[model samples]
Target: MHLESVVCFFAILSLGSIATADPNPNQTGSGKQLYRNRHVARQQLLSTTTRSVPPTQPHVTPAPTFTPTTTGSSTPLAPAAYTLSNGEAAIAIIGATYAAGIGGAVLMIGGTAHPLAAGMIARITGGGPNGDTPEVEIEDSNPVTTTSSSASSSSSAEPTPIPSPYIILFSPNATAQEIQSVNSTLVNHAAPNSLSEVVSHGTGLVVFFKAGINPNQADAIRQAPGVGGVFLDETLGVDQLPSSEQAPLSFASRRSIDTDTPGSPKASVRNPADIKLQSDAVNSLKVISQPAGAKLTELPGYGYAEEAGKGVTIYVIDTGVNAINPEWSSMPGHKDILYAPGAAKTKKDFLNHGSCVASKAGGPVYGTAKNADMVVVKVPRHLHTSAVFTAILEVSNDIFKKKLKGKAVINMSLGHLIPDELHSAYEQLLDSLTAMDVVIVTASGNDAEKGVNDVTHYPALLGPTTDIIVVGAVDNAGYRAPFSQGSGIQLNVSAPGYVDCANGKAHPDTQGRWGTSFAAPAVAGVIAVWLSQDEYKAKLQVEGQVAARVKKMVQDLAYSRVEGQPPVIWNGIDPRGLSCASDHPTGFIKVFEKDGVASGYYDVSSNSTTGGVTENIEQWCLAKCTGPCVSVFLYRIRQSASDGYYICNQYNQPWTNNLVQTGVAAADSGVVFTKSLNRRYCNSPGKTVSRAS
Candidate 1:
């Protein structure tokens, strides 16, 4: 291998060139000082080069050495000239030598040196006593400083001299309409020449300009229509930019990392044969396969050992869990946090929406990951502007203020971008949970036509400390779900969630299952399982631990970035790269790199609840708050075991006290005992009793 340059600049002076002349004081002082300073520069440059690379490499390569020739100098450089160290100049010369490959280094040209370049040299080796050597030395020695402008002009003549674009952040609250306004405003303000590209983050948007766009511009937009707030893009900086890969901690700041590595108690990735649907509507539902812990002999768990989401309390801090399943009631520690009273205090499905979610989420013994416990908290929603964010913050308050033991994993299947007092509260709660080390998972959203602009949803935008796992919807072919909200900007990872929103003449899968909203719970369940496993424990944090695990598992299972793409690690996206002007920012999730050469999927959606409300009511009567009639559940059924609502079925299925039916009882209503709990259409529980009607 070739040896690296010994000194950035080696003066090969010929000894024979020296001229014998009488002593000139002015010449002696300047010439003598310059010679000594040059010598010091020589030594330091030699040292830096030698230590830079490995010593094992051969150094047989020929190197030009420095030599000084005697000359009668005009003005002598003062003693201060010796202050500049060789290290300062060497870096400059190297920079000038290789401008294309590396950046950030300043090139100080001589015979033609740029002032800024000179300034950089001076800064590198400065005035302080502690400083290795003063920049005064190099400053005094360079005679051609005046011509620096010309040299820089010459060097810059070549293409690609401009610095890379700065990273800019966008607002999530920005809607398509707002984005246009902001883009126009930015164009009008300074660079009226060109338009700024808007990066859409679905519910939220991020915009980055070729030129710098300060926080003020962001603030200005905040006051504009549909704008939320603006903040600096803090995703990149010098430390995070990459200095020394192995350097001992770059900054003193403390950040959290997911402690749940593979060896830990956490688990990842689980599949099931089928989720047991409700008894009444058997027409459309079918158990293609049983979920984990359902038929253990058939489905089985993913880990080396069986792991269930036992201790981890999963709180769905959005529309509360409608929870009608005998399986939904089976979970222990399941509770509701409806702070808004009659509204958020709902146990009944609001429009039957909550039930559809709980069905797939906390569900029939088969749906709940063998490892997780579920909690459904209803957060009020303003359809035009999703206001459920406060529900999450309220849940966080319970975790932080109450110091709620066994913090729950929050699953928010709903999202909206409206800023108000709710946001302030939301931030407070997320900050606390992130600090407490709780994980929050949210859907990437399901609002894209032909899938182009995918903006990020929040609480998904929580701090780095909080492991806010943003999931996107993916189809069985590993392609991004058309309805699934996407964009590389905010999604952490994707999951299989493509059924179909509503049957459309265009898309037959409509109403079938195709949205990231559904995909989020699966991830929530998997996270719960990982948390329950003895191996994960308190190891993984939401950020470093859980996010990392998900990334690894996705890649390990051969998950590519996109359908026809390569696998990308859990690397954060360049928020600046997003184009708000385009659609489906998160839609780029094709399958970067797959488990096999190609493959895999995710699901989440927004609909007016799927399983139908009436049936859910009957299921509730027979399972959760149902009285003595609870004895006939397919999974497990029994009356309250403790002071709370709970039941145990013949199959040993465990259920909790949830969603008590308003009216109707077994003995009074005559809900026959032939099959345990049965429903009737009469006025009171005592009026009509029908096992088979």
Candidate 2:
């Protein structure tokens, strides 16, 4: 069927079913109007069929300066993804009521106002609800109308408009040496169809480098100095059109972020050689004993936990997995969920990476929840902007359609270190999930050293609409892994995942599996455990409580205070050991759960220090430097009424990581801190926070 025809069919169907719905002042005319932008983009693509896939190598060109396209439909000019995916509001203005040649359909912009979007627009353009909005009685439940112009196209044959290229940042800690090194490498290796540009933000610098030449050349650029890392730097056979590009998503671990897969792993234990592992919760367990503990059969005193992963379902939006292992031999259902034109993955999927992740969350091997159901997607480990963005949307569509979609938690172990087109799509997807109260978890990328502490993996950088759960790694001694991304202001909390993926003293698994990639699921598992609790039955409640408590617990309980370290603001470097802002800066947090928390941690890099990655951001922000921690994820903290802990409120602190900051009407007063900062004393109601000098 033609794209227009399909849309018309859906529109008519919708209108017929809603004949009795209330008339909306927010929506003019019938709600069945077709979208003009979708039609325009599709027409553009169809007319310029050659433009569907972008060139392998692309040169950065100035944005085309052209007259705005004439509007064809008076209907909404807004796109569906933003309105449809986000559930906060269902009303919006698609196109201006008075614009010339506007399309006829009236599209409800479809969702609640985006806080960051609102702030950014206000900061940049100065357009927003002003003095006229406050005194007016506004109902929070009423839908809102928004108006925007549609992208231009040459003709009506093409149906979809292209997206403009953009970049988002997590945090950047590149020193002069590192930044210089990265810059030199890219400039020197500049080749065909390649483009590089750096845009610094409050968090870090976004060095956007496009693909050129071949895979080998791309690999070389990926290794450029100052350059932290690169993925598909060029178009994946797709165009650089505006509509085609989207930013990668961010996810937080604070929302009762569960790493929990189906259920804790289980075994029969009929023989005398099995490893004695016990289940603590679904898709979660601990290795109680390992002797001449043959992993294949049962030990004399060991018993197996026969189980199912209960009602929870967890998703892994990475590669596919081996679903037929003995561990999953009895699983009721396991399916592959990836599709491309003439390409679809089947039950016999490929998931070498997925297997490792599953071992920690869902299991055919060992996991937090043995019975937790799983949804596996076979996205490429590395992909071009178009492919990655498309993959993100496709996965979200699947999530919307699945029976287990609402309650399941999703863990994304794969990511790009830099923000790209996929970011926006991922953000919308997470917002969709958040509104439904689905748990989302992601690993902060593995690039922590070489002063790359600030940049994070995809989905890990998304905003609060996700109610996401973000995680970093911790060492066996209960301190943050030097390489583990910190929650300073952009993330949530930590978990005991190490380079080797070990569980306890004397026994380890997956040796050398270091990276935040290996650490995230531990937090996921913890979220799963929390979800099983009575108070956290609702996914939204689980995320909020767990995220809040996580920050509190970690700040108060984790790690021992190291003495005599250089203070963040030592009045003078050696202003000869002059008084400093902090006599002892509490730089680390520890994790503690009820007994039998089904915990696992590895012992490597014992000499590693916590907070290097995040502390860098705190320092940058404190300096009132351009870069500030955009959001804070309070992963864990000590329970209220616990001893010796002073109440800390969330306020905008400036550089030097000191509580004393300037410019805010009241940086020290009450305000909801940005979700990215993960502040325990956030803009949320809490006492002001300060560190001892």
Candidate 3:
């Protein structure tokens, strides 16, 4: 039989016997209209099917009284009336009878049936012969909408978009309840678990929201009671340069050593084995000592106090240190490697940058401050600016809580460009930390290629404010490295940018690391050494004095081969005293002779002695003729006929020969003067003045 003929035959038979029932009193006008529409549609389907073939003789039969059946309960289940359209009713009937002919009645519907349609099929094809019920399979399709509720449900099935992360810093005075209330409001406005506390220091409570806040939402947050500022949390990376260009080790191929293995080498300056490992790599350490002069080929040994950085704690905020590395291990009194919360269980030095940094800062074998305690703060390898802020805040909070103000040093070998509005927030953070007497050392950044000044580099740019020490990079020769950012006043001091340090590998390569990342830690290590000293410890006891004192001491004791350049950092070990020639007074030179006439030289100031005086006037010149003192005059005043005392006079202007003097009378009256000379006197003539009589 043709498919249409079979379909028409089944359609007519099923429709001819559909029992009519009383109209549903609960149905509304729309429902009644829908029922009528379905009935009309069935009639059209029957007419179309019949025209395709000779119509079967109409067999008129009385509609059978519907009898309901119950499986377990005595109450019979009423048969439901279906409101399917004509096409749908025909498909159901064709499916049922076709399956019945195949010995097992199996009806397959194109889409899920409306509940009423399912009942209608069950009633039409009662249980098959021998009571074996036919199988019904529903192939999923676009939902059939026969009611308003079905349409409403289909519209609600779309996926929700995810929110982005943001950070909000609350005012310092915001109470816990107020903070909680604000958090509650934000949570209700965004997805669940949207607000989390990033840091809660004395300055403010920093909270992070994963709500992907819109401008209006951000404005709402800004206007909230007690809220200080709202910032979009942005991603950042380690300050270390990309390995392919400048870094020695490829980050992708970097390996981590198993520190748990037996016989691992531990770093200890006193240990013979540890010292041997460091003997070959002391160029960076050797260069930091004494004044910058001839290049050093061999290690003169790092001159430092035995205390090294004993009680000081260096918090390295970077990729995280390899705590298992022997460099951090085996220290007797100060071997504990502290970690911030959420950083303990992770692979500590995944990128190798952090380990190298920490090693240079305080590693026993390779660090400048070999005995310092270390706190490793592990941020993401692909660091975020918010994470950096949180780390800094956490360290500050930790130091404050532990009363480690002067003893704590934070080394940030990382930086990124942030929005202008955030600059104040950063300054406030550093200012707050410095106020607590903590020392902060940061890299000037390796952004020379960007052709921008360090003013664009943060934290480092904040160096001018005296709250932080910004360190740039220098080569082994003590000249500023080509890649080091900032010069002159932009940098506090420079350090060896390239160095051999632990890289967390089993067999670390000899290719030394390079970048301001390494330079920063070297200065930090020296700061640790300073903090470890008894004098600095006492001086730093005064709150807010650490940064200023450290800056002055580092600069005063720095090694500068060139006169105008910012000096490279020195560890204050065997400091070379200031040289008058090296002082390089712009237009002044050494006085070749001291004539017994004081008229030409301006007697700016004088230093005299009552006791025995050795008239080495050059030493006096070096002492008194510092800044702005252009000339010095040695004077001998007769206290008695035979005894005389010497006086040293300093002048602001160079002495001139035109001023007349009364020869021996001025000389007898003890008026003798020396004129300021140029570089020619020191370089060519090499003349010397006789001691005053």
- lDDT for model 2: 0.32
Per-residue C-alpha lDDT of model 1 across residues 300-411, encoded as one tens digit per residue: 1111112345566677644444343333444443445444211445455333233334444444332334335565665333221112323433454455443433335667
Give the top-scoring candidate (lDDT). 3
Instruction: Count steric clashes of candidate 2.
Output: 152
The numbered model that scores best in TM-score is 3
TM-score list, all predictions: 0.37, 0.37, 0.53
TM-score of model 3 vs. true structure = 0.53
Q: Residue by residue across 280-356, what tens digits does model 2's lDDT show?
A: 11111221121111221222211222222345666665544554443333333354456421123544333234544
Error of 2 at 488 (Å): 1.2
Q: Write the per-residue lDDT of candidate 3 for residues 1-693, one digit (tens) a residue.
A: 000111111000001211121232112121222222111000000000001111221222222222122212333322332222222322333123210100112222333232321112222343333343332322111222221122132232222223456667665556666666556545433333444565443434433333443333455467666776777665431133533323444221222211111110111112111111122236677666533333344333454544567788888876556665656653322543333323444645655667778888876556777667888776543334455565666676667666776888888776544454555555666666776678888888675655644433456656765557888876665556666787666688888776777765544422357778788898998888778877556655566577778777777666553344457776644312212343342223444344454444455545446322355443444344444655565555556667655656666665554543446443433232343432211110001111111
RMSD of 1: 26.7
Candidates in order have lDDT scores of: 0.33, 0.32, 0.49
How does candidate 1 fare on TM-score?
A: 0.37
Give the Å shift of residue 651 in candidate 2. Answer: 62
Give the least accurate 10-residue stretch of model 2, judged by summed lDDT: 566-575
